[model samples]
Target: NLASQLTISKSQPIISGIDDIKNGKVPGNRIGLLVGSASLEYYLTAVSGGNPNYYPLYSRDQIYQNLLGNKIDVGFIDTGNAEYMTNDVYCNLTIAGSGFN
Candidate 1:
């Protein structure tokens, strides 16, 4: 239930860590996660402290696309997906802070 992790833009200033989300530095509505996904629910309850203001995405590709397009400020994708994005896919994006598990 805790295998999935998160990554965000290295350049994003508002959110450097999960604590930022919990502390309200990053607006809950600006966070992106897959719609109807268990990870979304887990993150909402475990990381966001039950704040339900995340933007629901349909797929990981959409999450990356939206992040690159600036439609979404930040997103939570699997750690491996984050690696692929930063290494083989979107070069502009990188792991935000130390990442969250």
Candidate 2:
């Protein structure tokens, strides 16, 4: 399952929950979406509602790089990968919100 959620930089403020994203709470945040990914599909359908207010990167590696580089405030990524990236690889990043497929 491509269950996904948000991965945020440590320096960025934490969102309360996934509702904040669906309700457009983080309007000023830059969301990084992997192209052709389930997370992108979710954002397009549920979060963005067809609006494209995000940065489109092409790889899972790019997601981590962008978040670590501060190129994006948040990354919409698969839950497991996001967890590994946050907890194992990029210790300075954090997984925010909840998982959804």
Candidate 3:
């Protein structure tokens, strides 16, 4: 799980590619991009088109908690952490696509 991708709750539909992201067909639009993370580009370019209205999480725990709590619908994270978090620590989440480096 060395790649990176969008992570969403199992309750949401899986997004198979970047087209889904750009088309507003993601796991719900309430995105949580951690401040200062590389994921910001995705949120702004793919999700918001530079609107900056997406939810801004401050930490890894905060992002996971928000997703689990339904405060946010999705997050962008490294696939390694995404795998461990979803498969081992939290079973209700999943990577949205095949992931990229």
Candidate 4:
């Protein structure tokens, strides 16, 4: 049921897209994520079957800046925050799609 839900909707699965995933030059890409957030930790665990490399930012604003400047390829943010972030000028980030991290 969880897997089905993840595949079907953007609500529960909380996925982010890789620029490389859409473009042809590269295949899979790394996703930036928050260190303390349980959702991020869960996604990381699920993807790697263990912990993986993640960049820890001090503030959400810092993460927004990084996303804007392209320092990090992509990030996993909650859907509620995602809406605001996309609308924010500093980030100007967009939701690429829906899937598990």
Candidate 5:
């Protein structure tokens, strides 16, 4: 319930890389978050770090593809899924630093 916890309480801030949310640099000044991603729903959104400005993606694969293609600035994938996506041969995506654990 960290997302809920953080969503309710906005004291602690969720820090992200500048590149992920810079004006006009990132699409819509928003990052893609998985609606079903527990970490993103709780952690990333808790402090309004990466709140949804657009629509949420159902599958991690979609997030991965959007991120790699620069359609979305960033996304929240499980650490495991991040690893898997990073290993994809077709991807040229780079992780935004220090957003998640």
Candidate 6:
């Protein structure tokens, strides 16, 4: 029952769609995922066709911080967390895509 959403920093090149990620247009090493979330990890791997470049983050706040700092180019977060991050003043993130359980 894990739903996830893709987000990127406002400064990143606009990702037109999910195809960019699947085709390896997006740098693999720059993708971030929650450290302990098995579902997020699995989804990233499955979507990327088994390419493993997803960085494991400590928490949702860390994901936001790393993304804003350009430490990571993209991140997968809980859908609800994505909504909050997008609306929060401190987090300048854009919704790139969404996936459901």
Q: Can you write out model 1's per-residue Cα lDDT over 39-101, one digit (the tens) per residue? A: 787777787777678888999899888887777787887777778878887887876655555
Model 6, span 1-101: residue lDDT tens:
67777788877755755667677777777888787686455655566666556787888888888888888887877778788868875456888865644
Candidate 4 stretches with Cα past 4 Å from truth are 1-30, 88-91, 99-101
Instruction: Report lDDT (Cα) of residue 5, candidate 1.
Output: 45
Q: After superposition, how far is residue 79 of candidate 1 from its true place, in Å?
A: 0.9
Q: Candidate 2 or 6, higher TM-score?
A: 2
TM-score of 4: 0.59
**TM-scores of all candidate predictions against the true structure:** 0.82, 0.87, 0.80, 0.59, 0.56, 0.81
**RMSD score of candidate 3 (Å):** 2.8
Off by over 4 Å in 5: 1-29, 43-45, 49-54, 99-101
Residue 43 error, candidate 4, Å = 2.4
True lDDT of residue 89, candidate 4: 48
Q: Evaluated with lDDT, which candidate comes out highest?
A: 2
lDDT of 6: 0.74
Worst 10 residues of 3 by lDDT: 21-30
For model 6, the stretches where C-alpha displacement exceeds 4 angstroms are none
Candidate 1 has an lDDT of 0.74
> Against the unseen true structure, what C-alpha lDDT does each candidate score?
0.74, 0.79, 0.75, 0.47, 0.48, 0.74
- Runs in model 3 deviating more than 4 A are 26-29
lDDT of 2 at 4: 88
Q: What is the lDDT of residue 46 in candidate 2?
A: 82
Candidates 5 and 6 compared: the better one by lDDT is 6
